[model samples]
Target chain A: MRITELFNDGQFVVTAEVGPPKGIDCSHVVKEAKEYLSGIHAVNVTDNQSSVMRMGSLPVCVAMKNAGLTPILQLTCRDRNRIALQSELLGAAMLGIDNILCLTGDHTRMGDHPGAKPVFDLDSVSLLHTVSQLEKGVDLAGNELVGEAPKFAKGAVVSPCSDSVDAQLAKMERKVMAGAEYFQTQAVFDSEKFISFMEKAKQFGKPVQLGVIIPKSAGMCKFMNNNVAGVHVPQHMIDALAADKERAKAGITSVEIAAQIIKECRPYCQGLHIMALGWEDKVPELIKLAGL
Target chain B: MLITELKSKEILDSLTQGKVFIINCHGCKEVSFPEKEAEEFEKALGDKVTGILTTDYVCNIDNLPLRLEKHAAAIEAADTVLVLSCGVGVQTVAEHLPGKRVCAACDTYALPGHQGVTPLEHECDQCGQCYLNITGGTCPITACSKSLVNGQCGGAKNGMCEVDPTMECGWERIMRKLKQVDRLDVLKCPIQLRQYNK
Candidate 1:
């Protein structure tokens, strides 16, 4: 089913992300998608996630489509300029990949090629706007398309745990204005903050998929807290993970935390965006644990 | 005004060989200035220091010449004029004092807030293409870890940036605001390609 249909259907949506391999091998991606297909409404194919070069999200998305799985094509502004991005959009449409998530990919400084030149010619907002124009049968420069324009379930991202609520809200407003029909938020660990954010986000009248990440260990939790920007791993969650002596047991605790967040934030959001962080196998367990 | 931290001693050493003249800015009082840092540099340079000139708002290129005129003789004696100010101050001094070797002793970093006032929790990158009007006054350019204009990235876990966990994600806030203002439709308008040259 289309992500939009899931949202409009008024059922709790379930989504997950899968990384394309650094090389051209499609077997792993295909395998992961097969594992996730039954449980998720759609799978997001990341484009060079973390600035690390990976197989293009489009090809992987096409593979997922061929596998009878819905795919959200993750497009980032970090690598492609407007010309390249728009061209790719047309290509994705031609391949019948309609679900697209626009983003400003992670900075090159964070990826393997720190020296690579960044091409943020158009940010996620601009990209979303371009998608809207294409939906209307025109290009960014208002050029008419010879054939039918591709229809899409345009989506964008949000972070409810923002330090500045006003700023975050402002960007969201622009995305919505740019024709984003749905939103998937950054992972949400703080229940209070997530709830408070939901109280406000509901006013937009759009389905927001709360992001959920299961930490594998205390060290992982600490690494996210220290290194990841905009993510605040609660002291209590860290303390819980650190309390476990066995790394295996700690992984269980991570699921418990994720399940707890899902349970708490479920009422406010329309769906859950589970970012397993390569722990794809655990998603089923997490969903069951959260009672989703 | 930009906040700057001193460069490494090794870098400073590589930039200067003979007599050195120091110039520091006391203009950006709202933010921390390297007062003790300048004192340390002065002590470290010892006999090689020709003179030290502390001026207010070295970025004010108009008054810099008059300030430098007073120290003309001392400036002429020094082989290198070292500026312990933000990039703007260093460039201003370099532009005015041609033929003399001008070097900056510090690098500037961004702070939140705008205008010539004390920075708060929000900052602007002045990326020429301002989305503030549609973004409910939040600048995606300055806020997002990647400054993504379209939306949030997959790296964001629990609403935190994969690159930095302590901070809240930028796009998350934008979504909430757009919903609040009921102007989510602005997102539908194609944002013209940004002009970075501005």
Candidate 2:
């Protein structure tokens, strides 16, 4: 079923993310999603996330669809030029993938292949615009498609807790103008900040899914706090994660923290997007604990 | 001023294999240049260096011809004309001296204000459409890593960019500037997407 239909029916959507493997064999990830992520609104398949080369998100999304799951294909403008991006969109549409999340992907320097050239021929906004254009039956070059135009429930990202909240809000407005139907935010740890952001974001009249990143450990929290932009792990939360030195119970602790965040943010947003970051197994427990 | 650093020694050694004439643009006034590094490289080249012509503003197309005319003898004697300047200077020299093999000895990097005549703390990408008016003097195209015109991405922490931890977040700077000038209302205006074609 289309995510748009779920939203239109006023369903409280829940989604999870899974990264494609570096190699061709995708059976492991597919099985993992089927086991842990079934009954969710959708699963997001990352596209060469963090600039690291991986199996294409399109194929993984197709695999998920074949496994009787709905997938939201993450499309980034980091590797492909405008032509390839458009072609990918067309192919995804033909393959029955109806959801796309447009993003201005991470710079190439951040990934495994730093030497690779980055092609940002179109950014998230322009790519979203291109989707609208394609839906209208014409390409960016004004060339007409041979047959039926493909329609999609276009999604976008916003950093609600960015240092510059006004700037983020401004960009969010642009994304809406560029035809973003829904928004999923960067990892949000502070419920107060998320509430404030929702106050402003609600005016756009689009469904927003708050991003929840499960804290694996205190070290991981510190890494994200120091290195990841727009993500802040409160001191108390870090301390809680660090309480268990052996980390034998890290999985349970991580789920508890994620569930707490989801419970706190549930009242403000339309849905929750759990990013387990390789700990997909804990998602089912996290959702149950969050009272979802 | 366009900041330039010497190319890797291995690459330079491979490119300057034969008799080479060096055309070093000392760069504009107040701009920093790796003169000592270039000189050390020349000294290392030793007998392979035919001659050196150190001039200013090789990017000036009109003045380039006269400068090349003066170094015509040195350029004629060498199999390659190695330019120790920015990419523009290398292209200018190559255009003026098409017969000789032209090579760049230094790689150029964008300095904040190098695009303008006088160096400032800001840069203009010359994207043809100026957004300074709306952004309160901040050029998101040049300042932001992703060139996001709408506003900040989610990667900034404590006023620093996630991409380059050392650099200040472009959106933070813009937001501060807007608050200082009482133009924060501009941010509340309707969404405006940057025309990438421009």
Residue-level lDDT tens digits of model 2 in A132-154: 98999999788999899999999
Query: Listing candidates in order, what is each one's chain A TM-score?
Result: 0.97, 0.98
Lowest-scoring 10 consecutive residues by lDDT in candidate 2 chain B? B114-123
lDDT of 1 by residue, A155-267 (tens): 98887886655546656776787888999988788989989887877778889999988877777878877666556789888888888758546368888889999998888
Best by DockQ: 2
Off by over 4 Å in 1: A247-250, B1-192, B196-198
lDDT of model 2 at residue A64? 99
Candidate 1 has a DockQ of 0.17
TM-score of candidate 1 against the unseen true structure: 0.67
Candidate 1's residue-wise lDDT over B78-125, tens digit each? Answer: 977888765556656765675566666765555555324323355545
Question: How much is the TM-score of the A chain of model 1?
Answer: 0.97
